[model samples]
Target chain A: MTEHPGRITREDVAHVARLARLRLTDDELDLYTGQLGVILDHAADVASLDLDGVAPTAHAMAVTNVLRSDTPRPGLDRDEVLAAAPEVEQHRFRVPRILGEAP
Target chain B: MDRYQGGGVVTEGWELVIGLEVHCELRTETKLFCGCRNLFGDEPNSNVCPVCLGLPGSLPVLNQRAVELAMAIGTALHCDIRPSTFHRKNYFYPDQAKDYQISQYDEPINVDGWLDLPDGFRVRVERAHLEEDTGKTTHAGASGRIHGADYSLVDYNRSGVPLVEIVSAPDMRTAVQARAYATELRAILIASGASDGKMEEGSMRVDANVSVRRSTDATFGTRCEIKNLNSVRSLGRAIDYEAQRQVALLESGGVVEQQTRHWDEGTGRTETLRSKEEAYDYRYFREPDLVPVVPDAEWKAAVADTLGLMPAQRRARLVELLSGGNGAGGNDGDGDGDGELRVDQIATVVDLGLDDLVVGAVAAGVPATLALARTANEAATDAEAARRLDGSSYVALLTLEASGSLSATQAKVVLGDLLLAGGGDPAMLAKEKGFEAMSADSLVETVGQAVAAEPDAWARYCDGEDKLAQVFVGKVMKATRGQANGKAVVAELQRLRG
Candidate 1:
């Protein structure tokens, strides 16, 4: 959908903000669009590299299979965890009328 | 909807294309990233940690057993193992504490596999990727459904539980094929120890992507995803209903919209849950917390070794055993003591993990038909205990029934006791239940009375109406209090006729 690489349009900023549930003013949108544009442009500069042998990376660390055994350990107490929630009912965290899957 | 065809047939010339996404929970002791117990029906919110709750400063660590189970599942379906990474499927929902589900996108661990149904149909598996499950949310207030629910309570006990969502290519054509694919995949999941495969318990779930086209050669039409199909029966019913709905929409000169719909099992129809127009753009990005999962060759082989005989292999083994190691494999059987085991009987036995009992009983000189029948019918009634039913106990019950020492009904009663007790001496249970075999003379007297009372039927039986023999046997069984052996009754009836 990007016609120019790393070019963040105001519409793109607005769309992404809506997806992230961020209510942004027009001035803020213009500001973030420029900020995000510069950030993406800096990152997209990697595309200029000509060497093709580099493997894609998910993390900065070179670790693989950072696994733990399937063992059970006691976690946070239910009372303690529920105490931090905004609402509680019948031993569960109650939220206001949140419907089914995200649309 | 008024013109909907019966049995989910879209029109006479239309073709049904279906793809299934099955989410199965891995049978591990802890959550996918944390050490909290991965259990079902525990106290609400009991299993919670900083990592699973998406608290800041907490890092995620992969669970070794989850990866192994996923690999075993992929191997069972003939998948290619590869290095994979996780991404965040960003969305907002009460079920997920993170507000964004960590899932595998673009790259997954297992790919390009195929699952073969017992009837020789193969559904290509596109990918099987690991992810974390979400919390349980129960809607509050009127209707209990989301339509009018005032609030919803969330339990994070299920949060971060390990799940592998298997996406299949849209290869299925008929509703029957979709059901069969689910069934066969469930069996494989259980056999490979990847999951418990209990759909009713939510260990395994299915969502069908159904579309209708004019013909098999035509391009696929827009599909509406049907969600929350909990059982194989409901999976078939939902697919049929969704197909009919799409076809009806198209025939009425209306366009089918690509959307997600919930299959209401109560209403027996698929209702729109959400449409694709407002679909969330799940901002997928790599998780910098956990590193890549690159399964080495040795570890992959070790996982493969744990995958024992799948359902198809077990069914074939039982079929070969029932044929005394010589009969060809086919389902062409009547199952009336003709020394041939029906294909469906073998499938049921194997599916319930009762093939070992059948194999054991048949090896003890019990006729294959008798062993297969009892195991497939009576033992199948209590599959949980039947799986643990000892070989000797099953053989003992079958021997008594086959040798005319106990009637079929007596064997059934004693077998029920054996199953309930988990294991017991069959003869002792029979004696304790006072199920004594009748004397031949007593049996003759009983058969004589049954024949005399059913003279009209007996007349036809004598004139070679073989089907009437079952009528007299039923009558004799009732008179003798179910202690009359069917074979002996038949022999005595023949003698009286001569």
Candidate 2:
């Protein structure tokens, strides 16, 4: 996810920061632009290598259909799970008023 | 399935184009990634496990039953099964157990299929992807909207439940076509045994992408995604309102903006919920915990075997039976000779899954048309009892009617009694109801008296005013206390006119 599509620009970093809800100073934005740019360049160098006959890999281990049979079992206690939340109301987790806006 | 050229749900010069995304929950014993019970109406937060709660140190394990159900749904939709990978859809919501929901992104499980409506309109299905459900949140405020809600209560009982999101291409050209597509899709999901397809309980939900364009224009207009359609009726109404809204905007020289709209059932309008920009940016990335799922040939075959006859096929089977062709060709379905054989009635009978009763009766020498009418009208009224009603009893009742032993009025009453009391001899029920066939001489006298009572109408009938048959038949029926056969009365009237 840290890898860029091509080259990472400062504006791209700012947009990513906005989506991540990170309030970064201008200096930090500039710093991450350089940092992510190098990572993208390394990724590009690896991508530029010629290995035409090799199949693409999505995972390192290269396995498929790792599954488990469906069966019901006990879960965490309700009170215990609700206690872990920041707020609880009426036997449920309670959260502050949130806007309809999205990331 | 009536094909819309233009101006079906839009203006005369406009045409509607709609694509639907249907999200249906998978019927499974456990959560998609955990063993916690996937049961609804349970104690709140009782189903929460480490994996579902997104707690650290817990990795997800795909449920085999869930994958099987997804494949079954895909096969029922006639989609090509393929390997799929899960990705994290990043978003922020209080009810989301995970800030990034596990969903299939670019690679989905099913693709490149089409659903045939009973009317034979083929709607191409783009893809059906596997995803997990979110928790339920109820806002506590006057408007019950998140904008002004004081707080929200979250129920994790539904979190991590498996779901299949079936997306359709923009092929529908009217509100009715969109509705037919949704209804057919629901039937397919239920027939595949993948989901219950209950919209009231939120097992199945639909989001419509609707736009209208000039009939002469090749380019599509800006579309809005209408969300929160809980039922099929709401789906049609919302699409109709949204299409009109867009058409109005264009006519007024107001450019339509791309946005997600909310359907307010109470207000009967669609309003902007949020900009499309905020909704589409789901920074998706591959889930490292889960591997890709690829169904082999044998597994795909097994999934395909689970699909039974869907609604469309069932409807065609009934049509074939009605037309006296053993699944050969379509029927006139004009509903003229024997029964009110309208298309919608057939659909209703099939929807209730009662076509078997009609089929059995037809096989037993009862007229198919009469059997269909009784099945669609009387039996459908008490569907549960009718499903349990014996085929022999049904055939006996219809046989009595078809053989002219019992008048249509008496037959209807007998059928109602059979349905209410579970089962009985139809002939005996009619006799108990004092239904005795009027003698031919009495019917002739009754028709003569009826003609004398309305001489002017009789003269007009003799002059070929064909609508007066019901007037004389009514009189004869009343005089004989609904015991006289209508056809006999009509025959007597025709004799007197000649």
Candidate 3:
């Protein structure tokens, strides 16, 4: 029903989930594979639609030249920001090892 | 969760390709697509509204300021400001409650620009577009790991903030150049007044795409995307480390795999985060709720006008002005008063830190030269001192420097004391602090005293131990408590010793 149909498969869905850091179960991955295929296929259909004369819209706001004076306002209150974090030490946001070891 | 899941990683004679997606939060008071506050590091969930929070029944109204800032950046980067439209980039994440992000698809705000490097290489700007920011998420407990974490906390303060995403073409050859390009880009963005461009505050973020290939290969090798590279040094170092890793793998007859990588600042290395995916991953499409974005002719022209005289051009102009004796006279052509006034003007301009502001002040009936000199004199002191010196006191500083009663250096000391003494006059500070320049005659007398004090040094000087002359000069300078002109003292000593 659309161009580029079936380009995305179950493997592609799994790859995407990994990229997005989403831990999806096998059943969810299979469902997303089908759902993503349909969505991309629909996008391909839209990409193929006859709108040669239609102008592409990038922004909805018809405004321009919005500028603030070159004045530096007060920035973040350091102590106040650290208050929201569940755990903070020495003014730094503590996080576990996200990157693995070498070798 | 398994750390590695891909079938095969690319390893030997393979090159890696990279691209960058840099997003800078636009410096504006209001949100990108709404009237809610556009701020960073605010009280948790303080600057949020229904539109930003993705509440049902809330309609979107685009902030005019965000669009203008986007256009300003587009034009500055020399992008073709295509009459384009917006689309919804759909993705479901906990931080983004909207389930879809309203961003430009094929029709970005600007397209096809190049950033010229000093080394004759150019990094092409693929496109720059405007979008709203999502809230931040923090995984807490269990060593604060994203996986196996007890719970994840979300902060909505930054939600719906305006951002300009500047995507660069794969033109960077080395890690150093990529980092340089990023730095220059930040300077331009900051100068343009489009964004605060503060990396520490997370106002500006860089997503680096790095890959390496052989010198002879025409095709690019499998590339890895390195995300979360914070500072300029880290970006370049991460790229270098990743490239070396890839090259080592290739040299060892291994294959390179296409994947997204995460950079660890602590370790100064990159690790596999996830394999790269095709565009279908996000399932991007046009948002049915929002219509296409369109800017009128008048709007475009106004934005163009606002991007007037960037900081680069202003720096050049200031350099020319200083060199041409328009200010800060290096030498007067006719030996006429070397325009101490002009020197003041240059000093003022330098003190203001913003050329445009200085120019504006000059045009506003302020004696440009006097105001500038006064500004310069005040700047050389502490903030308190600068505040203490009333308008009239600055004039006294210029007069002293011009009349040769005090050198520029001494005037600064006097200004500092005046500022620190609070309620003290600069002239009185100079008199009480003995901040006066030594004249030729007084310097000679001090030099004679030093020569007499160090008879052995005088004998060393007469014996052609030329280096001892410096010792004599030092003694003379010390005797005068560094107030004497060491040059004049040296000349006087040479004559007496001979």
Candidate 4:
């Protein structure tokens, strides 16, 4: 994982924001680009470490296989779960027209 | 020079390269990360919880059974089970309330496996990774499609359900081969007891990547992914239609664009849904909530021990049984060379999941051919009942048929009754149904009376009009109210004629 300085461009930020459905303004994109640059710089610094034998860590700790039994427990009431949504219809969470097909 | 005929044209000088991605819902009792019931067709939103709903301050805990099932699936597919981690696939969709999905990235639990189809073509499995399912979205309005819908309703009951996405290498050369791979994979999934492999209920979903290439070329063409294929038939049809569409496009001086297409079952064509440039970049990153999955050797062995006979192995066993041989000594090296009837009988037995019943009958000394026919024909009619049937009772009925104590028709009728009514004494049931076998002495007496009465028909039978034996059998059946065995009557008539 080599460092590529100045790669977090404003255009990249804008494209990612758009994909995330975030309507970011020009100022916001520029601000995020610089912020993202700092984060990438930190990642680059970590990548430049000379620890060849160090294994990549997906989690902060060495914990693995933490799981619960598959037995079912009571879930929230239908009305209670629907109460948190903006709108409810036919015991379901209703939203505006979906713009695109499902992935 | 192998060509396929579809869309009113011979697709000559071209080959289809297809790969399939199948998502199967694990049969866990609860959701993947929450204690909510992982049931289908429940009341909408009833199975949701704060964890699955992605409420603030709620964290997800992996289900132990889900992991074991995943391991079982990996073992069944001959994949290497390794420590795997989950990542967040970032996307914006109404169905995913969390605005992202927790899925495995880079390192999955299973990798580098291959599935050998019944026809003996091996499809390399790239990976089978674990993930969570999204909610259901129902589009309202006239078209009932997302393009022109008033609004969509989301049900979170299915959200956060455990799913394993099995990805295959682009090794299939024909739509038929693709279908065979899916079918065999589904059987493996079922055999592993990890998933129910129900495609119609959305438990199993298949997506295909299809591309066409010149027969002499080695490089692959631009592939288009077909989505929302619900059935194996639809999968095969969509691949064929899409492959032919690409060939026709290239032949007519046009280039096939790499895109995602929707299989329209009504129109029987693949319609463009989205193109490659517009495809969503998932922006995957490691999930900060859950930990990695590392199954130790002991646990892996325990899961491996649960593996049962897969469909292919079961099919081979049934074929051996049908050829009148035991498991060890069955050296019919050419079971595949047998005629199509034997092939179909073996398939019917295995596909119906009744191989164990037939095996049990054979173990009980019943003839293999009779057991295969009974299981495939009579028991297969009601699979649910047949599954619960007592194997010994089935063996007893077949034994009666084999020992000449009951006619074939009487045995079949008895078997059907036993299947519907659950376990009971087969002989007692036969007696209750008035199917008592006719005595040998009485059969001779009846044949004598029939010969004295029907001289003409008897003389015709003696003169080698073998068809006239039916007349005497019919008379015996009429006198005995269908209790006398027709075959016994025919035998007795032959004895008298001699």
Scoring only the A-chain of each prediction against the true A-chain gives TM-scores of 0.86, 0.85, 0.68, 0.87
Which candidate number would show the highest TM-score if scored against the true structure? 1
User: On a 0 to 100 scale, what is the lDDT of residue B294 in model 4?
Assistant: 90
Best by lDDT: 1
CAPRI classification of candidate 2: medium
DockQ of structure 1: 0.63
Candidate 1 segments exceeding 4 Å error: A1-6, A100-103, B1-8, B325-335, B338-341, B388-396, B399-406, B424-498
Q: Per-residue lDDT tens digits of candidate 1, residues B106-205?
A: 8899999999887798899999999999989898998888878899999988989999999999999888888888888988888888888889889999
Instruction: Compose the digit string of candidate 2's lDDT tens values, residues A15-92.
Output: 888877789999898789889998889888989999799977767888999999998989999888988999988778
Off by over 4 Å in 3: A1-103, B1-18, B118-120, B145-148, B277-280, B326-498
Candidates' lDDT values, in order? 0.84, 0.82, 0.65, 0.82
**Which of candidates 1 and 4 reaches a greater TM-score?**
1
Single out the weakest 10-residue window by summed lDDT for candidate 4 chain B.
Answer: B1-10
TM-score-sorted candidate list, best first? 1, 4, 2, 3
User: How does each model score on TM-score?
Assistant: 0.83, 0.76, 0.62, 0.82
How many angstroms is residue B295 displaced in model 3 relative to the true structure, after the best TM-score fit?
2.1
Supply DockQ values for each candidate: 0.63, 0.52, 0.09, 0.73
Q: B284-356 in candidate 2: lDDT tens per residue?
A: 9999999999999999998788778888888888888767843222121224543334576678777666788
**Fnat of each prediction, in sequence:** 0.91, 0.86, 0.04, 0.92
Model 2, TM vs. native: 0.76
**Pairs that collide, model 1:** none
